[model samples]
Target chain A: MMLNLAPNIADPDDFYAELVNSQRNLDEEQALRMNARLILLLANHIGDRTVLTEAIARARAAG
Target chain B: MTNHIYPKFGYLRSKEQADGVVKRHPIVVIGAGPIGLTAALDFAARGQPVVVLDDNDTVSIGSRAVCYAKRPLEIWDRLDCASPMVDRGVSWKVGKVFFHDQLSYQFDLLPESDHQWPAMINLQQYHLEEILVAKCRANPLIDLRWKHRLISLKQPADHATLAVETPDGIFTMEAEWVIACDGANSDTRKMVGAEFTGQFFQDRFLIADVAMKADFPTERWFWFDPPFHPGQSVLLHRQADNIWRIDFQLGWEADPDAERQPERVIPRIRAMLGEDAQFSLEWVSIYQFACRRIDNFRQGRVLFAGDAAHQVSPFGARGANTGVQDIDNLAWKLAMVLRGEAPEALLDSYHEERAYAADDNILNSTRATDFITPKTKVSRYFRDAVLELAQHHGFARPLVNSGRLSVPTPYATSALNTPDEDFAIGEMRPGTNAADAPISVAGKPSWFLHCLGDGFTVVTFGKATDKTGIAIGPLAAKIIRVGRDIEDPSGLLAARYGASPGTTYLFRPDQYVAARWSGFDETKIIEAMLRATGQDSARHPAGQKELAA
Candidate 1:
């Protein structure tokens, strides 16, 4: 069972890969991880603790 | 009458035939290179009449530059040209570094940027120019003059008079402001009498574009101490025209006429290639680089931009990319000046902001250049040692990445910023590791969205409000209150910007946080903005001071 972010795209990794792994040099897996780090940092800057938790949880679940 | 038959690209307006003999535009740009074209695109998109002039009749040949940074691509996206550039260009995500043909390590630009739209694209300079020229040509308001050269210019009290040499004769056209985007060896800078000084390389290197048949990795292959060729190492890059850009870093003692014989050059390349590697030469160039910068960006109405302002070695391809960013910064400010939304004094920030960027690029490129061709044996050994450690330690890899490449820059020390609680905020230059710093937004084009209360970001933590009436400097700017709550913030933005009970941030149009205030003495915040924008100070007038026409 998967809690889809959107319809039809069951594997979140596909969209995540497009968003996070579309770039090369920093491999797709690495890009997803880096994007996660960036998201956390930005969420911290925004002072959004809840979003940060959700983001991290989502990232971990996807991985 | 001297007759020069020319093919017209629509925006090429001959001074001989115009509604008016000379019309003063809001912004007058010199040179139609990448920087100038981007400026024109930005300013015109914002409903500004833009004029671009170039001395050359056609686009520049050869792969002069292909590397564009994330920020520059976002600027292109704003111009609606990023899609074409992205589509036409190849995404070189990871680069393979080989020491003596043995793979040492691979580094990727993707993870660094988090797979943003502004991914590193290997499109040629011709592609960039083609898109820019086409965009400019379509704009009726943008008068792009090809083959028209700016011989000399005069900046008087109100306007600038450019003595442009056209096919028929010298034509005089007055402009409100002039932005010079001439290449590194800029002639427009000379007329303004601005001095550019920095590092000049002694060794002249050869870059030959060969259409190689071999199917090497699409990524950049940097061979350090190629066993076959001890003295000269090969740097290969795939260009758009199915040609490979090969740079043979010959030692400083080589003669200038090395490329005169392709037979001699072909064999040096043949050693590295497969037996069936067939290729033909597209273009070969000999260049000695200079890591130099101008003293100032603005001289009255005439502003120097791009290579005219500064030139760094092409180690990281920061030369064209940085220069293009200068235009992006200046274009909006210039549009404001013309539209009368902001005062002419607002233009002064162009010098202040980009001069710092120029200084930063020079330092970055110089370090990279030095790393590639280590002048001293000690430095050479140290760089090689780092490469060696890079094999064993993950910590060492980032150290090499930071050596000579475009990193996001933070505006920490900028006069625009004030002392925030986080002193670390003051160090973000455009292309430094500071750029690696996280802004509040995720999966967004902006490095940082700056969740300030929607006024000029005054970074001073306390009391920026009380000094609101104080004159900061030439850029007379006033602050507005969007009334944001830092501590008890509600919304994704409030959480991201840390809009807590007392946290605050000021954001500029480019989305850079101007200043973050933690409830400090408001005067210092006002003082900083005044000084930064050239307002709040009596040196330049605030609002409604038109050019003395």
Candidate 2:
């Protein structure tokens, strides 16, 4: 059975938007994506290479 | 015996004594916070020498992370002192949201599985630390030193040299590696020139643990635009000692001190409650959270974990959970490299796997925080709209909860992977391949293997096959009889992971599944293990295909 795979739990592209979304000026979606990016960037900084590569793949898997 | 650690010699001392006692360990964990201490416990459980240091005079007495998730409880079980924590903690499964004194929504957190531990437990963070401190104290190998402040740290080829300022004076200690479980403001990370770049919220929130009386429902309650609180909202969580953690989302520009006055805070509560309520404030903290991460977890022999690596808002309880996972990924591997069993590349995977996990945690928490407490005018409007819609539409509630946001991080696909379908999606790959070791030999071990949550076990089957990675450990291999229906020795593993016969699993001194293999392809599986533990898999019992095949 060929099943469609969803993205990995950690997607990096949404990094910046998720971090700053909490700002009263930013939209909720923007803040969420900012929050997501901040998390991804931090992980990238930590050198969790395999998880990072896989996370990138997870992000790309959808659609 | 040659490599075992003695607790009294390991950690939590004044800066001066530690400066004088020159010693080397695979990892020297700084700061015995929940995450830091968990890392030390896992490292010690892996039969490696570890020295843990903390500058705090006592076990955390502050309003740190009080909400314990199910995953962390699993870790505490591995540390061999979960009973006290479970006994003292309160389990809350039912929660509701109230809008202006009317109950709007309710939900249950019990995910179906045949496990005994509740999904979420409420205990003081200090209580959890107290239990962990006892476990760390019991471990002859995990050293716990409190009140020892880290002044300076240098990363060398073989170790990260730490110069700590303790009660006595300055002293130096050498370790094969240094793992920083330091807080968000890590001096070690700063000293190594790693930049923590991200958003710092200008808005401040008031988090108060209080004892109160009111007609409000006794569940996890969230109020959206209550009468008195026109703009702000309240999050009430019942905690130990008849205390409730209340968070008021005071906008970024509001005066912090004004919210503290009994005249200011109590009237607001009374106005919303529709009656007078008596309450005593336990602790009130103003937190302007940061969504930040250090650029890298490692610089030479030094590594970062916990809050030192990444920080997120308190929503969804991911911060400490992700940090605890940091130790989960690194501890056993450090034990292996120090024991001369695996390659240095294995240590590199810790950063790989955990950094990914940390990344996910930060994003999840960030998303949840943004939704729950929006900063912008549109988001605030949209959030109110979402809540209003939720009041009428059942569809919106679950949609909101889906991203309540959390997951255990793993390296399912990477340079370390074999390109399976599961890996294609970045989900946790569950299969018997060349990589996994069985959880038990008596029966088919669990793929998500645990050692009844204690002690170390090496699992393999078929009258014995010598594996490379199993050679260096405090525990021995679990040899299985492939076709035999033994009483489920690892019933919990079966419940958690659903493993069948002819499987191999290697459980660390902590009960977490280190690596699992489908069957006897010795080299490939050992290679993954070796890579994980910072050793060379190319040496003995080599499997060239673990990565390639």
Candidate 3:
């Protein structure tokens, strides 16, 4: 499957707020771990090889 | 002073003091440390008169700045002082990094062969200084004055007048140009009122120089949270005279004075080297480094180089290596400006180019320091994760920064560079340091770097019949025809420059590539030389018209 480039989240602001809220009151180290787990969980959910590679490339290039 | 003997040159009164005359010199270099002495040698080699003043009579007291990189060695080779240093130094090219008890990464610094020097050589600061001081004393043009300090500096646009304190008394002297290599705590920097700003590392490193006779190979060994020192990093390197330099990372809260005691230090070494290892402490010191630099390298007639101009953490051996390159970049520019061959505006490029290098060094140093000693909890976790991943994954190996091990960064964005018009493979581009390849000169084996003259060079790959007269404005560019003046029999030189024949590379006086062309074009070469010398304003159409004839 092709990686989705356009906005797909129905409620983008609410989703961002939920993502931020998930790590609320957590220490910096714990928040970092939570982010890592979140990334791996989302990566496994989208199990398309080409899409995963493109997503990783896009994230690194944006950096 | 404990294990090694310091040689005292002693104080000597100058003839100017005896005559009681305030004489003016061509160039005055402050601080006879490695940087100042090397600058004096370079100036003298260029037939320039120089006077070096230092407060102390002896070389550096301890084994500081251990790792000397390849570029600095090549610079010293041109100055005729690399032989003894290489002879006495412990040359190494392999480095091993460990996480706890397991090996994380291993690297070969110089994989290719035929180069004159190794990737790096570990030598004490004092020993290198002595070798440089002896070379300086032998040169008549270098007037090295020991036990003489600069009391005050007065810059008057045209020249700088310095009040020097000596054994006799305070005497005044003048120099057309003054270079301050007085090191990190520079009095000359304070005198000039230049703003030095950067990040100060909150951590400390306890440098322990211990003399030991061991069977271990000469290599750099670094550890991240090793079993011997849990939660702290350690660096190990072997120097000359059987002295092994070990740096132990101490957090900011560790008491600097209490940690330096032999009672506290001996146990740590014993834990690292095992219970039965025999060694004697040669020197010990707790140092907190700051990565900072002066806003500009040049102020009026006075200039700053080495640690006086910029400071960096001990990681990557950027301290003295970067300092040597600073002098390498500045000395040639100063010589050109003084000789009237180049305009005074050429000196501004010194600050531009070297400050770029200084910023690069500070960034690398800060990154390494942060990785080695993470200030925040998340940073420490990230560093630990990288170290853990480094053992299994190739991608994480590059992320593990145990001091990026000092390689000269190319000034790719330098204004002096004529952006490559012809495609060439490999890393040899405009504004990059010239790489050395083994070649034969005069029917004898000689390196590629040794054959380059003391001025701008056009390294052209051609046969004996292909001789061209190329001039860079008033200056004639020295041409080294690869197949004639030098022979690349193994084809390494040609391969490195990406040339079969008819490729020309214009090199600056400091041996950095200014431009390269597919064929011998005098106009393009002259234009590049004009730009390199900061005469780009004359690089317009009319000036090109005048230059065409």
lDDT of each: 0.65, 0.62, 0.88
CAPRI band of model 1?
incorrect
Who wins the lDDT comparison? 3
Reference-based lDDT, residue B394, model 2? 68
- On DockQ, the leading prediction is 3
Q: How many backbone clashes does candidate 1 have?
A: 61
Give per-residue CA lDDT, model 3, range B219-337, as digits (tens). 89999999999999999999999999999998889999999999989899999999999999999999999999999999988889999999999989999999999889988888888
Tens-place lDDT per residue, model 1, B1-549, is 101122344335574434448766677888887888888887787788888888876665676786776667766766778878888876676777766667667877666433346446777777778888888888887888877889989888998988887766677888888888887778888888888888788766677777756677678777777886684556778866576788877777877686536766777677767556787777667777898888888888888888888888777778777877787667767766676645687787777778877777788877766767777755555556556656765545554532355644554466555446554333332222112123333333232222322224433222334434223323333343323212212233333344433344444545465556444445545454544444443344442133221
Q: Interface RMSD of every candidate? A: 14.2, 10.2, 4.9
Cand. 2 Cα-lDDT: 0.62
Give residue B191's lDDT in candidate 2 (0 to 100): 77
- Flag regions of model 1 displaced more than 4 Å: A1-63, B1-20, B112-115, B395-403, B421-504, B517-532, B537-549
Q: Write the per-residue lDDT of candidate 2 for residues B317-404, one digit (tens) a residue.
A: 7777778767766776666667755466667777676777777777777776777667676556556545554567664465343125
**Docking quality band of candidate 3, CAPRI definitions:** incorrect
In model 3, the Cα lDDT at residue B323 comes to 90
Candidate 3 wrongly placed segments (more than 4 Å): A1-63, B424-426, B463-469, B537-549
Which structure is stronger by DockQ: 1 or 2? 2
RMSD of each: 15.3, 11.2, 4.8
